[model samples]
Target chain A: MTTGAKRPKRQTAKRTPPKAPPPWDPSIVVFACNWCSYAGADTAGVSRIQHQPHFRMIRVMCSGRIQPGFVLRAFEKGADGVLVSGCHFGDCHYIFGNERAVEQFEKTKEVVKLLGLEEGRLRLEWISAAEGVRFAQVINEFTDQVRTLGPSPWNGKRQQSVGRAAGQRPTTES
Target chain B: MPELAEAAKKTKAWACYDCGKCTATCPIARVGGSYSPRRHVLATNLGQQREIVENNTLFTCLTCSLCDRRCPAQVTYTELVRDLRELSHGHGVEPECPHGGALQSVMRMMAKGGTQQNRMGWLSQDLKTESAKGQVFYWTGCTMYYDAFFPEFQVKTLEGTRSAVRLMNKLGINPVVSPDERCCGHDLLWNGDRKSFELLAEHNVKLVANSGAELLVTSCAECLRTWKVDYEPFFGAKPPRIVHVTEYLAEHLPDLKFDTDRAAGTGPDGDGSRGPVRVTYQDPCRLGRHLGIYFAPRQLLEALPGVELSEMRRSEAAAICCAGGTWSNCDRFAKQIQVERLREARATGAQVLVTACPKCQVHFRCAMKDPNLGGEIEIEMRDVVELVDQAVGQK
Candidate 1:
């Protein structure tokens, strides 16, 4: 009984919890189309796999549903890289949906190049629902690729100050 | 029957994921209950072959790649749909349309080579396409010609393109222009007119080869994409090296110089209170998402002196469809889509929205005309090349 009563004396020693680690900058936003890519991502989660903490996923209907604007938005919003993963060829839950996405990806790649973003800031891949490992691999590889690119040139080029060069627009909060 | 199966064997449609994103983003699906790209996709993957081929959904696909832009799979949904539509048309299935048969009228024009003749309507006089004459063949697809609304753009772009080619010549590269160049089979293939697409593709490919051009250059994003993907797949061998005009410029930017006076100007405010006049950029679905060429245009924009470049909420991979390309103009919901996109563009607070592809400019203009959104904001839309043209000398 005396030992149990000893716990009540500790009220003066209130301990503050430790602060969480700082957020990862240049966050990677992955739009995983449902059916193939989303399921693949889910599998990666269920399998208790460890992947990059920077990747945030937005499950879309299909990779084809991803618009170029969405990727640009991610970059504008401070994401260093954007990845789109879907079913492989002929494997979209929606027939031919990936086909359209591939076409769009082709165009967006050129846009990425134009922005002077590092080569891998924007990526397109086909990951099947069964390819949980592949999904994780893509994330790892793309995350590394983006990390090498550092902050998007635009992140610093966006100049809010006047008299700065046109290309140097100050980065606004996306 | 002409190696259809053999050709079909080469396509990757067998890997579809059936996400229905294509249907959701499809402009046609919005208006016509007669079609569902999602259903067509599901049916196709399930090998419910009959339903996919027989249903009007196959045809109603604007083939715009909006769905593909959103698709996570990178399946090339638009291209697959085109392939399937071609097969369906070959098998005698007709697509349904709300245009009350106007699409057929355009198809007739395509068949008669009227599209070629109309390509340069922006020219003050009849403009003749000079032969490549053993140089690079420049493919000016239908939108540049028949769509008379974008005349200044076409003319200026042609001028810039010509200058760029001359610059290339200085660098030991000679590009050719084909007077007899045909359409790149974009409309025909997307419209479900397979026979016409094949005929045009064959004609254009043959014309390019016959011109003795080592590379094929084009201003149209759709034409470049079709030549690279659809046509290349058909021929097996690598076709001519296809280059978009913007790509060519980016390659030569170091050597190129521009006049600051022409490209940059003091704002109307005079005080320059704003940071380089917040200009938003719209990535054409084909130019931005399909081709993955997002940065070149941005680089060009950034290079402009005193220009503040902003972005729409969705750009690059998430860029919304203006719904202008792939026959979306024929759909009733086309206006609504245009309005929605215009709103997004305006929200960026950019006085000018710059894009690389001419079709995107056309679509943006169409969307801006809607009473609902058009009046809400006043934005000037210019092609990246046009902006470059302005930045450089008037040519």
Candidate 2:
């Protein structure tokens, strides 16, 4: 169940230095809870569900542990889209952790929109430990949405804007 | 006024020697109102119930406690005014409320039980918030509704709420902030509706108390005042600790810094520049003299490198009330007072006027809407939390 592994380079005509540095492909960050969505990704592989290879997953004990900062950091580090999938409500191993996840996810979604990030770049879903097909479908759908957004403005120095730079480096006293 | 004359004597409202010092220091008196504190006291003490009640002068008082500071007789003029207002209500004589009393009506409606509110609609997408579970609870107190009601003011009143969450997030505390918060009952209680006030108070106290947060923070001055002062009597016993956003940020100022990269130098208007933006402060009466908090906001403002704390002439304890708030007592005198305060702020050469209350921005912006005015407001008005949020690189 690993994703976003480096693939074999495609043959291309020799190009000048001014050409694009790499192939254009979507990059998505997936936040999966230890008890549910993380294991679901494993189930996706065991069942061999065909899905996009754009996801890079990070596992936490509970989806409720994710903060807006983590999402902002992912975007700041060049994530074109983010997928937050936790256990279905009421089925959370932690009892109410998925509920908290849902609320916090809704909260961060609005903050993302205010920061000028497209609504399609961030998502929240409930994919239980057994929902491998659902997990794969979620990744594929998110990849298509992010594909239309092209590269995140946070991709590299070439994409940096004054606002994004200032946003990333909020000043604090020495 | 007659029924309160006896209670007034107990509070020493009968001791006015007609020295007129209260009149001289009164903002309303200076505005040529017949409702001067000196005159009101003299009339009420002399048993001029018919005249005082007929003229409906009791509502004009801001209850700011300015005259009490200089009253040689220590007459407790503000307390007397409150008593008189209660009596006037008992007599079924009430002062007129602006906006056709729509805001007051909403407060009255909230006082009743079983009203549902979509208070959380103002929550921005990325702002982190907690349910009734975190250690710190932020009381937004009717600001969300006000922003919608007074959109003509063009002020993002709820941005203060949003920034408050962001600021708290930066402080490393996930605040237990709920949009389900009821009005703190400031206007209802001050306007002499004890029954309604208690109803609203009971609802709010239960909500916050259930949140398990020992500390409560609010950006609204009236809410802070109600929590700091009024919550004790209605709810009984000391309630959760309540801190204004200014106080909270000031205490954490050492841990915060201004955004050096965002300081693009003061461009024209709130240009997201860091050019040492000169800001004058409007002391909302409830936060200042009403609650005795005049220093925290200044400390927070001074902590920003590009922010210069400019002082207005009527600042601190002597500051003029925004005039439009409190029981929705909006009137011509309140409008005049607001415009005059804006003039004082502009006179200080500050690019912005900072306040800890949302309605102050609403009142000033409403007054500036007058097309007949010589010019539009030259200075911008902002809430202290908005300033703090920007200093920490929040929108």
Candidate 3:
């Protein structure tokens, strides 16, 4: 090449940023009625039934005690899924508590859906005190559903920032 | 104590002059509650922090600002209450909110962010909306949550919002409706949850900035006040031009066409070709006393071909509150206030009670559902936008 000739510029390789790792281990909150679902969970434990351990159970006296606020609060505090479990319609210890739970569940589900959460994230089920297999099955199914959906959009960095912004301590749980 | 002193100074609670005008004008006080605005001011002026904090009456003030209108000394009684509430809330005291605080929780959750809201479920096929960014941004403002929460009331809160969009579409403007938009935090701020309110305000302000909107329109009166007044500090220098839907519609009144033939028989009387429908208007406190928008809704109603405006005795600046505000202290006093307001509407001989606020509609409907009232206060309540939508006819 001549001394006056302009040398071609060297091609710089475009640096592609590494992709973010896939989010794992969805957190779920389960409101279990003390009369049935909670007992059923205990039965599942006693029978050595293997199930997903991703959910934390809150034992309310009845599912009727699980108001829309409770479910919304769970989601607000960064739950990936919420399962409200009670006794069957006619089997509530207080007779109409389960029926009232159905009403409350419907209200909570509407709010959860409107908040842009996946419908699969919220579930309501009836389990008797003896249904250990059913409890395990529900746990496995719910955990799988949440897994496919990945970590909640309401969790992670954004939630932590919100907590900080609101002058509350950031929760340690994922 | 320093905060209390600061709040008193900021809100001009020092200018009370020992006048009982605020107490006299207070709807809550008139309903025979021990909650007196005058007393609250006195407590603040005297630096009685313990009494102010201990009294549950702090949460009972509607912050309607009617007293502000009547305060000869120019004392902002509403802002004083708000400041006091903020101070009290900082002390870990909470308002005994109605609905088991479900609505408050919803608002707080919205403040927390990160959820992709399905707020557009109410957007039917006909109503046009921009997906990303536009000149006009429409804030839906918790109507979706309200609809789901108060299904027993059978009030279609989203119907008002959808109608608003329809009206905008008629004017050839497809407003930006963001699913990412959160609550305007009116109730949270009024509820004295300042931290949550600030978070929501920041989120909404940033979202609006991202949308690059010049005009922000909302259907809820409370949202209008929140965005226009409460979000001012967070917005810094540039904020979107905000207007209530009625104000927006009123501005474009000349261009809008109403099919009077379609609206002729919408009155209680099914007679197709009779006189214009007699409708009374309830001035929402936020739209009237707070924002000084007394005529926009009336102008729109008057423009409708077959709708006649009937003024309640308590109209404009003198209008009463919906009794239940920010979803707190909804006790018998609130019920009594609602019942009285509804009776006033009934007395006006209007077939329909037209209001611009969804919360007003909800509260009135709840009062009407009282088993003892026996339908005495059961006038058909309609949002002003809904009536306009009905008159404009479907495209």
Candidate of highest lDDT: 3
The residue-by-residue lDDT of candidate 2 on B1-395, one tens digit each, is: 34756866767977778999998888777887666788778877888877766777778887778888779999888777777776677778665665545455556545553324557777777778897787889888777666655655686788888889888888888888775677788887777666778888888888888888888999999899888887876553546788998898888887786675564355325555655778899999888887889999998887775788889887898898888657546667777777888889889989888999997888888887877885656567788888778767742
Instruction: Give the 10-residue window scoring lowest on summed lDDT in candidate 3 chain B.
Output: B265-274
On residues A1-174, what C-alpha lDDT tens digit does candidate 1 reach at each position? 755655467655557564343322456888988798889888877876666666788998988877655665566555678888888887777889898887667655544443335666888888888777887778777766765555554454223322322222122211
The C-alpha lDDT values of all candidates are 0.62, 0.76, 0.86
Q: Which stretches of candidate 3 lie over 4 Å from their true place?
A: A1-27, A45-54, A156-174, B268-273
Candidate 1 lDDT over B1-395, as tens digits, reads 33233333443444556667766666656654355666655555556667666655565555556776566665566666766776777677765443333334334334444222323333333223444576666666554332332332232334434444444444455556654666676766776676777777777777777776777777778888888877874663546787877787677676667666534554423444534556778777777677787787788777766677888887777777666566524455666666667777788777777766766766566555556543784467666665555555533
> What is the DockQ (computed on Cα atoms) for candidate 3?
0.45
* Residue pairs with backbone atoms closer than 3 Å in model 3 (clashes): none
- C-alpha DockQ for predicted model 1: 0.01
Q: Which number leads on DockQ?
A: 3
What local lDDT score does residue B14 receive in model 2, on the 0 to 100 scale?
Answer: 74
Task: Give DockQ for candidates 1 onward, in order.
Answer: 0.01, 0.01, 0.45
Task: Please give the lDDT score for candidate 3.
Answer: 0.86
Ten-residue region with minimum lDDT total, candidate 2 chain B: B263-272
Q: After superposition, how far is residue A164 of candidate 3 from its true place, in Å?
A: 24
